[model samples]
Target: MLRRIPSQLAVALFWLLHWLPLPLQAVIGESVGELLYRFASRRRHIVMVNLRLCLPELDVTERQRIARAHFRALGRSILERGLLWWASAERLKRMIRLEGAERLRALLDDGRPVMLLAPHFLGLDMGGARIAMEFNCVSIYARQKNAVFDHWLFHGRSRFGDQQLLSRQDGVRGTVKAMKAGRPFYYLPDMDYGREDSIFVPFFGVPAATITGLSRLSRLTRAAVVPCVTRMLPGGGGYVVELGEAWADFPTADVEADTTRMNRWIESVVRTMPEQYYWVHRRFKTRPPGEARPY
Candidate 1:
């Protein structure tokens, strides 16, 4: 009962926020982010720790700058939930620009299954919302604890396109079923999901725990892995969702090696935009046996 109070408040807020201009919402979000950076001590610590580990070459001052920018991005993402949830299709389409449209088209036209490899960028949901406008797809879903929030999430994600968001408990079979039904899977495979179905792989040179689902899913479903990322343009210039061509020669019968390859690819993309990758997460929480926990 107590929890529902705040979630109901958040739902109300999302509706209110959705009515504002996107650029104005972004400005407000940046202010909120600054506040979070100043007072959200625990999350700030995690972000700094991640930066220190992942970007060893960067000095403290440089990393701090990146961390600050990241907070601003994170804040914008929070407020942008309104747009994802309540904004009209025309409004969203005008703001979000798409790249590599033809590549995705070609894959769908060829009757090939696809797995959109979306990393944990702050504007990730934006990419999902935009793609939802065009394609019907399946992806992993994590249900929020609060009922109001969970309902809001489900409603917002499904409002744009015909998407089946299978929960983590749904396992690979749900995804395979969806893909077989002709819906591409929007696979966001770059989070730290402890050690079940995960292998120790190098991410930014750290032996982080990562899921080998991409390889296994592709192997089972023969889905083409298409790398997708969304960049929140500066000054609320909206966003850019970029898509890469399908990966060839993937899932080479070695799950560990394939996971490593995926991580390496993510690391390279993170290098292109360090501040946008999700650094606030305790990505290295699960240590190898006999290894000290870094978080």
Candidate 2:
């Protein structure tokens, strides 16, 4: 009942925000996210742990600063979802500021499916939808926890031509189908999902148990792999979605080797904006062979 209550209220708030001016709605979202971050103890600790792992070179003060900033960004992202999911198409187009559209366009123009890799940065859900609308098709792999929430989120995400695949069961098949149809698919390759079918990969010099799905998918589908990220601009203006070069000759015959290479690529992307990266996730929870879990 409690879960349903929040989601029900969220839907109500979504409609309410839609009626407000875009700028005012964004401000309300940012303010709410800030308030939650200031008061949420569990979330605060998760952010701290993520910052500590990624930026070990920083002093305590610097780490704290980054964590606080990251939380605020997260808040803004949560608040903006109302606009992204339910706002009129014209309004959403105005709220987002895009970069690297040419890169994506060029990839699609080549007549090959592109693997859109994005870290769990701010505005990714909205940015993915924007890209999918432009390309006409996008398949994204997502982790599903609750059946009810999954149903709702999938519907919302698909509103902009982005298809959501559940990571546990249908993800691989869904991705393959998208590739065969020559459509771009998006995946977040950073999170740790236990020890099964995973290999030790260096992220920030620590061996994090990373998912090999992206590399495996590339190998299976022969799709071009491209890294993309969505970042929230300072002062709560809007978001920028950036794309980088396609992974050259990726997904060699060897799955483990290719997966390691892909992790290195993700590490480079995350290093560029360390704070915006999703540090609150328990990325290193699963230990390597014969090693103790970090947490």
Candidate 3:
């Protein structure tokens, strides 16, 4: 009964926000994010550490400023989930701007396997929804603890797109199968998942347990890497999903080198849209063998 009450309340909230104008939702989201910035001490600390390590040139004040804006963006994304899941097709099409998707389409049309390198940006769900509206894609997702929440996640993500959200525990086997079968794998490669299939690579000049999945998958499936990113428009403007040209000479002989190259590319983009990047994650949680964990 106790768990059921909050589950019902959460669903009620998703429904309530689903009815509001996106602009109004944006306003409330940012306010709630601001509150989180002030009160969510643990996550706030992780954000700070990530910014500090990744962008050492910036002073403390500047870094904190980015962190603050990050929380606000995070909040907006949380609330905007309603729009992604429940909004009309015309409404979503009008809101999301696409660039260079033809490049991806061309590759897919030619029957070449493709892997979309999607970073952890706030607007990524919106981007994925938009892509799934027309194309079949596969991606990994960590299940939410609450059964209701988990079901909602699966439903929302799969409703608009030919997306198969495989459980993280299921690993990359299913995703590889999807890619081999001509569906684009929306691969999010930047996160600390310990040192199982990961090798320590520098992100923001600090060694992070980075996955070599991109190169390995590409080599395994012969997929071309298409870098994709989505940015939230300020003042409730909507989203921009950008797809880059397919990378040539990827997964070149060395996995570590390829991993480093991947990190370098992510760092470059994150620099351009610093605030939109997901900073709430403990990206550097697993340290180098003897080094102490930062978070």
User: Candidates 1 and 2: which is better by lDDT?
Assistant: 1
User: What stretches of model 3 exceed 4 Å from their correct place?
Assistant: 1-5
lDDT of each: 0.87, 0.72, 0.87
Best by TM-score: 1
Reference-based TM-score, model 1 = 0.96
208 in model 1: Cα distance from truth in Å? 0.6
Residue 65 miss distance in model 1 (angstroms): 0.9
| Reference-based TM-score, model 2 | 0.87
lDDT of 3: 0.87
Q: Point out where model 1 deviates above 4 Å.
A: 1-5
lDDT of 2 by residue, 117-189 (tens): 8877777787777776676655554645766556656766777754545455554776677676767777777
Worst ten in a row by lDDT for model 2: 1-10
Off by over 4 Å in 2: 1-5, 141-151, 162-167
Report lDDT (Cα) of residue 229, candidate 1. Answer: 92
lDDT of 1 at 244: 89
